[model samples]
Structure formats: structure tokens, C-alpha cells
Target: MVSVKSLHGSAQLLLDVAGGVTRIAERTHRTIVREINPLNRLRDIAGVPSKEREGQTYRFIQSTMSSLQQGLHRSLDGFSADDEPTHSVHSEKVAAALNGVCGDHLEASNNPLAITMHFRNSQGAKLRPDSSSMGATFPNAGPRIVVLVHGLCLSHEYWKGHNEADLGIELQRAHGFTPLYLNYNTGRHISSNGRELSEQLQILVDTWPVNVEELLLIGHSMGGLVIRSACWYGSEPKLPWTQLVKKALYLGSPHHGAALAKAGHLLTFVMHKFRYASPFALAQHTSAGIKDLRYGNLLDDDWEGIDQDEFHLDIRKPVPLLAGTRHYFLAATIGDHPTDFSSTLVGDLLVRLDSAKGHHSDALKKLRIRPEDCRVFEKLNHLALLDNKVVHDQIVEWLV
Candidate 1:
């Protein structure tokens, strides 16, 4: 739901974006102008007499625009001081997309548009960590608890599979496993989200309606990385939720790293090295969460205080699979067969097969999973992992 505060936050964000784009365009114009304008070059040789005057004009214009923006922000604040209107599904999708791009900035700036992590049911109602609340949400609550986490730029709403049947619904109907969907901002650092999830799971387990016999976690894409991060933190503190976890499944997860994110990092690095491309590089401001996918960072030390724009060696700390929990790595390929070259080069069109299977060139980084635990589905892309019937059947079979 979109709140009044969200609208205010959106206005502020739009103003910030406009200002950033204006600055980038201005710099690019200045760079091109300096190279092409003989008069400007001559002025540069004669100590830049015109640039100072141009700078003054630019500053004046910027001041005027800033003042106008502030006025608009204040007006928006006053207009929606008390009312919050619910928006359509399209708006929610847009919000999710925005969170994926700059969620860290929105959070750091205290923007109400930033998404807060929470648990929800199949119907999209918020789930609370208490016996009565759990009973109310799930009257058929069972001992087996299933936690489903969605991927980047997605929500719990995206889990609908064939015949509009989501994994949660099928798990409950088939195996009496009560399911909880984790809804969170995909733009924050994976380690940060993982730590919070560990804490939240602790509370949920402590206050569950039924005695939890076993807990199973299923994550798709970036969600798998978040699950790994959470498991690492939970085990580090010996959290009770970690002990309850029976199996953790990674569906098309980039355990080692994602190829697209690596390509993006390389592109940004290359652009940063050149003068003309530097300003454009500023336009590629990605969230910390997106940056973490470069080498699948799961710890704070991997990224904190480091220059994100520069290319660096993969210094990610090795995190092993959760002890006493069965782990499954499910990968997919656009190829029709496993032996096809496309399967190796473009696993699911976003993650490579080796990465999804937790295979690393370095032995220290590879996940310790049995050969039988890894499965691949051919002729399927990354997004198809969410909705395909065969994928659902495979997951169910594994759980069974």
C-alpha cells in the first residue's frame, strides 16, 4: 500500500533524480564543449574568463531550481498530511522496481518509500510473530514450517505457479507444511537482510502457534544468497531457528556469483577509467545489494569501506552450508539439454550453471553438496523457475 509519507518521499526522490540527471547532462555538455569550442579553449589558455561567468549563471539557475523544488516538496507535505491512499498493482510494481535500483539510498535518506522487511501469508496479509496472530493467519497451521523468499525486483506476489498455485499453497496441501512468505527490500545489503531475517525467524520460532518440528527454506535467485547469508549469521550466534532448519534449497541461486552483475562491474570499472565515460559512470549508480552479486558477498567485511566503482579481487569470505541441514542447488538452462554449450555459458539466461551449482574454480569457495543434490532443468530461463509446473514438481519431489 502506498502511504502519504511515501508520496512525499517519492517527490523528494524525483527531485533528487532530476538534479542528478541535470548535473550529469551538464558535465557531459561541458566536456564536449571544452573539446569542440575553440573560443572556450582559447579562454582556457587565457585563464578561463568565460567559464567563471558561466559558472555563476549555472549556480544561479541551480539555486532557483532548488528553491522551486523545496516549495513543491512542502506543498506535497501539506496536501497529504493526514491521508494515505492505496494504489493499484502497477504502483506496487513500480515501488518494487525503485527499491531494487536505489533502495539503500532511500533507506539511508529515511525515505518512507524504502521497503521494510516483514513476513506475509499467501493472501498478502502481514504475519505477526505470536501464537494468536499465527492462528488467525493460518488456522491450519502445522508443525512443518516452510519459508519462501523471493528474488530481486520481486515480491511474494510473484510466487504464483501453474494454475495460480504458489509453492506455499501446494506445500501446505500436499505435506501439511505451513508456509510463510518473506517480503523484503532487495536493494539493501544481503548480509544486512540476512541478519535481520535471523532475528525475525528467532522471534517467529519462539512464538509459533505449533511446536515447529522442522523448518525448510526455499529461495530463488538473489533470495538464495540472502538465505545463505541468514543461515551463516544464525549459525554464528547458534540461533534456535538455525537448529530448526532441516533443508535449504537454492533455486537458480548464484551461490558463487552472477555473470550479469560481473559484466556490469566490469563495464562500470572500464567507464570509470576513462575521462569522457566517467560522468556517464555516475549514472550507473546501483544499490549495494546489486553490487554484492558481483562475487556473491555474504559478509559486511566484503564491501564495507571499499570503493564499489573500482574493480577488485574477489575477497568474499567463505561461508559453508549450514551444519545439520540438507542443502539443494537447483539450476536451469535455456538449452534443451544439459550437454548443450548454452547450458554452460548461459544458465537460465542470468546465472551460469557452475555458479548456480555452487561450483568455483577455487576449492575453498565451492559449496560442499553431494552430486545427487544438484539438479538442472533445461529449456527454462531464470524467471521460469518461479512458474513452471515441472520446477514445482521437482521441488515437491525433493521435499517429499
Candidate 2:
């Protein structure tokens, strides 16, 4: 059963997208029509045309759209009954998908799909560490805690694969370490999410019933970037949780930048160059979070004032691993072998080999990781890195 909130949110999203498309089409049509007519071009250049001479058809279109929007808003507002507080798994999955695609837009509009940070247990119930809820949240939580962070467009449920074996559960059984999963908005800027994560870790550590002896983080894909960002923020003032962190593992993370996002930037540039193709290029415009991944931006300043539509050299500052903490990277390739050309070009199908391994020409952008600490798993795609036994064994070995 779809919640009323979900239906309303979906309708609003569609209407917003349609409205934007209409505006873009109108603008494109006006540009082409005016450019094809020499008189309009001369008038535009000479600045001799009065305001009254402006296209009446364009004015009519704008007025009609405004009126329609007003009517829609009124209808929506009147029909609104509060949606159920609890969401079904299917609804949550749909919301997560929509958020991944246009989360930035949803957030800006204060939509219901905007995700928030929640610590969840194996059964997907929210965990609260307060006096009343701590016992229920962590009945067997130990001194050492391991936090699992999932990738973009994913929930904590992703950690539990089709197989009965999961890294978090295995770690708990083998090492007696308490496991907690972070569920957050993947569409937000990495740095923004990182800052929140840093603060949340502080709260988690400070409120733990047992004294935290050690902390470990395991992040996949964009989650890895978020973890790095959190470390960078957590170390500025030397947060208490930062000192407890013993090891951080990144799996299939694009440390430098993902190739697909860079390709999107290039496509956007090309589409913008041609006037007729400009409106169609609107489809390529993505959330700020996706744009930040183009260069693996980890700091707020990394993207400040940068033209997202234009191609620029990697200007991100190097974020070194936290002192006193050992960092390990695992990169996967879909190629038959590690040395194959396919592995070099398409790493794990989403990230490239060099990018995932933190290789860059710029010294400031390169992350220094010892060769022994890095591992490459062949014949595995990006998501497979999450559940592969070999990868799981390697992580266990490192942790032990």
C-alpha cells in the first residue's frame, strides 16, 4: 500500500520536473526564433526595443503556467491528510531510489523523501542510545564497536546480502564487537554528510553504556568518501571518537573521482556548446552530491565557487589518513584478471582502477597508502565487493 505522503510527493516531483521542462523548452524556442530573425537580433543588440515589444506569446505561456501551478498547489493543499508514520519496506525503497536521483531537489523543497541519519539494528528498527532506549538498542553491545556505512542509493539493509553471511554479523560472532549500521541521505554533499557523521559519532561514543575501547569503520563506495570526510572533520578539534578509531577500511571507493561523473561533466559541456541541444541537456543536470563525486570532493572548500558545468583539473586537496589509525583500501575489477585492459579501464564497473587506488598525478590529491595495505579482487563488480567471502576473509584477517 502506497502512503498518501508518497503519492503526493511523487506527484509534486513530476509536476516540478514538467514545469522545468516547459520553461526550458520555451527559452530554447525563443532563442532559436529570435536568432533566425535578423530584425529581432538587431533590436536586441541595439537595445532600442521597448519592453512592450517583448514576445506576447512568451508572456502568455508564463502567465498560463503560473495559473496552473497555483491551482495545483491549492488542490494539493486541500486534499492533504496526514500519512502514516511508519513506512513499508517497498515504500522506503521507492523513496530511497527517488532521493538518490533528485535528493538535492527534494531537500531544497523540504520533501518527505529527504533522508536523515538513523542508527539501525539487524531488524531495521531505529536505535536510540538514551537512558530509556539504550538497553533495547544494544542488549549485547561490547566495549569495541564497529560501524558499517553503506554506499550511495542504499540503506543499511544492503549490508545483509542474499547469503546468510554478512560482514557485520560475522565480525560480531568472531570478535564480540558490537555492530551498528548508519542509514543516511546519499544524495547530499559528502562533506555535509561527513560533518553530521562526525558529530553523530561523538554522540554515539559519549552515550555508549560501556566505555568505548576501540572503534572501526567499514565503508563501501560513496560511504568510504563520507567516512574520510568525517575523519577530516573529526580530527580538526580532535574529537574523542577519533582517538578510539583503530582502523578504517574502504571497499571499491573512488578516492580520486568516479569516471562516470567525469563523463557526465564532459557531456554537459558539449550539450551546452550547441544552442539547440541546450534544453535537452537539462536531463543531465544532477544533484550537487553527484557533482561532488566528479573529483571526490571531501571538503566544503573543494566545491565552493567551482563551475560544475565546466571541465576543470582535479583541485581537491589531499585528505591524509588519520594519525594512529591504519587505513586499508580494497579495489575490485570486473576483468578476468587483475592486469587485464578491462580492469585498467573499467574497475568494478563504476570506478576506475587508478581512481579507486588513489593514484593521481597531483601530489596534493594523492592518498598515500602502503602497497601491502591495498588489495585487488578480480572478477568482482562494485556491489559484489560487499559480500565476497574472499573480501570478507581479508577484512576479518585485517581486523583480527
Candidate 3:
């Protein structure tokens, strides 16, 4: 039998060990987030234009920042990974570095965001034909086509982080892929904007605006699911799927559902239990938050396909579900988990691996994607992965 004194001593030792490890890891992550992270977000001199004409892109975009200033609206705050209070000194230093380093880009990320979602309806003109139809010239290659979709509460500027463009450059040089940033109302249902997106893809592919070998899509958070929904519905649209898409990747995407969203809903029901914050919070019931609520049930057996009725959005295109495409899942799991069930702590602080992969969905189980189809990278999170160069490197490798 164990003596009481010995048991007490062992418990204390274990606690001390756990505390030490947590402290070390938190500090390491803090250093990484504080140091390397801002570098990824830098817009100053990170990208060098291939030619003199291209340099204007930076100067042009930077000009927009001259008129922009910080806007007042509280974004959700994250507690330190260390669970300790944030030091004002560190905060000030980080802020100063950003202002100095990023220059215009820093100003853009700070506040008064820029919204760049201007796309035209270029539908149906035959962008692809395997030689015999439009000669071998069609759908071969050109400037290249790329699609970028942003996550919640953000605009295309999210990807404007010069680090993001670095990824784009890699895609172009290595795989001959171009960049196209997609912007949609974060408040709309998946199906609503999804069908619209599919239609857009169809048009983008059908037209011979440029020779294109591959159509790549990069979506973060809800953006990932939106892309899937578009692909699912787009495959059978009037235009057809193969004409448009090639491959897609999801970063920190909650393909299954969000755990924090589920928890937040409970709090939303009990007013006093939770404080009403951003319109992004739960105030907009029909927003992405609500969409996330019903999102988990997406794997329902009847989920063979989704449309306006199921998601409560106006689906502009026909909802003919496709089987599955050569898609890849790149999730930024929390990385270091000191627990038995790593899945729980796997995703960014808010999302778990299981939910991000749509594993939590009974609906998806009956569908094409099985357990084997997923790939998780534990080093990323919702925001970090976007600016993180390592994440872009992996994407370039896969796309190429």
C-alpha cells in the first residue's frame, strides 16, 4: 500500500513537472509568435517584383494605406498560450515593430481594413478543350489562375500580407499557378455563396481569357468549407466541374465543425452567461456562426448534397453533388498536446482536428471522404498558418 506522505510527494512532483513543461512550451510559442510571426505579416520590402512594371503593385496598394486609419471595433481577444497575463512591454514592442517593419501593410492589418472583392461574371465561353475540341492550345497555360478565399471577419487584405504573396510567387514559379483571392459575405450560408462560387468557377474555367493547366483554391477556416460546397455543387452545374477546378487545399479549415462555436451557442442561449460582442459573435444568427452550428450535422446520411433549403441561403446554381476530387486537407493543429486524446487539443485553440476534418460528421461518413483522406499539420492555427511561410512552402510543394 502507498503511504499518504509518498502519494502527496508524487502528486506535487507531477504538478511541478507539468507546470514547467507548460511554461517552457508557452514561452517558446510566445517567442515564435512574437518574433517570426510579424515577419510573415510584413509588407515592407519582402517581395521583389520580377520586373520594373510589377513593382507598381506594392506602391499602388501602399497608396491605399495613406487614407486608411485604425477603426474602433473590438475583435475577439485570445489569452496567452502561457495562460499568464500579457505584458504591456511586449505588446508595445510588437506593435512598434509592426508599424516600423510592415510600414503600409502593418497599417492595413492593424485597423480600418481594406475590402478587395471585385470579380466579374465571366461565364461560359469554353476555357478548356483537350486538343481535339479547341486544339491543343486551349487550357494549356498562360498567366495561370488562382483562387484565394478568406476566413471569418476578414477581407482579401488578409492574404495581402507580403508573406502570402511569397507563397503565390512560389506557386507561379514552381507549378505555374496564379493567385485569385475570393471574397464573400462571411454572414451568408455555405450553400448560398457556395453555389455562386461554383458558378463563378465554371465561368472562370469556360472562358479562354488565358491558357490554364490548373485551378488552385486556398481557403482558411470557413473559407475551406465554402470551397468544398462550391466544388460539390459546381461539379454538376450547367457548366460542368472539370472545366474549372484542378486541386484545392484547406488551412485551419473547420470541415467538420467548430468546437468553440458549439460551446458559444450554449452561452448564446443563456444571455447572462455570455456577453454579446461582435456582430460576428452570435448576434448574426444566420451568419457563419449559425452555419457552424448546423455544420457538424453535415455528415448526415441524407447529406448526399446540400442546397439553399438545408443551409438557408439562396443557391444560384444547380445543386448536383459530385463524388470527390483530389483534394488535400492541411490543418494547423495546436501542435503540442500533453493529453491522451490528442485530437481534443489538436486544432488551433478554437478548432479541434476531428471537427476540422469533418470527422465529427455522421453525414460525411456516408460520403466520399473517409478517415484516410485527411492530412493534419499540427504546427498551424487559424491566423498563424496564413502568414506562416512554412505553411506556404507545404502548399507550394503540394500544388507543384
Which RMSD values do the candidates have, in order?
3.4, 2.8, 21.8
The best candidate in terms of TM-score: 2
Query: Where's the lowest-lDDT run of ten residues in candidate 2?
Result: 76-85
Model 2 residue 246 distance off true place after TM-score fit, in angstroms: 0.4
The CA-based lDDT of model 3 is what? Answer: 0.50
Mind giving the per-residue lDDT tens digits that candidate 3 earns over 336-370? 54232554664676677665654533442422454
Model 2 residue runs over 4 Å out of place are: 43-85
Deviation in angstroms for 104 in model 2?
A: 1.2
- The TM-score values for the models, in the order shown, are 0.89, 0.91, 0.54
Model 2 residue 383 distance off true place after TM-score fit, in angstroms: 1.1
Lowest lDDT sum, 10 consecutive residues, model 3, at 68-77
Residue 112 alpha-carbon offset, candidate 2, angstroms? 0.8
Candidate 3 Cα RMSD (Å): 21.8
- lDDT tens string, model 1, 335-390? 99877998888788899999999989889998989998889999999988887888
Better of 2 and 3 by lDDT: 2
Global lDDT of each candidate: 0.84, 0.83, 0.50
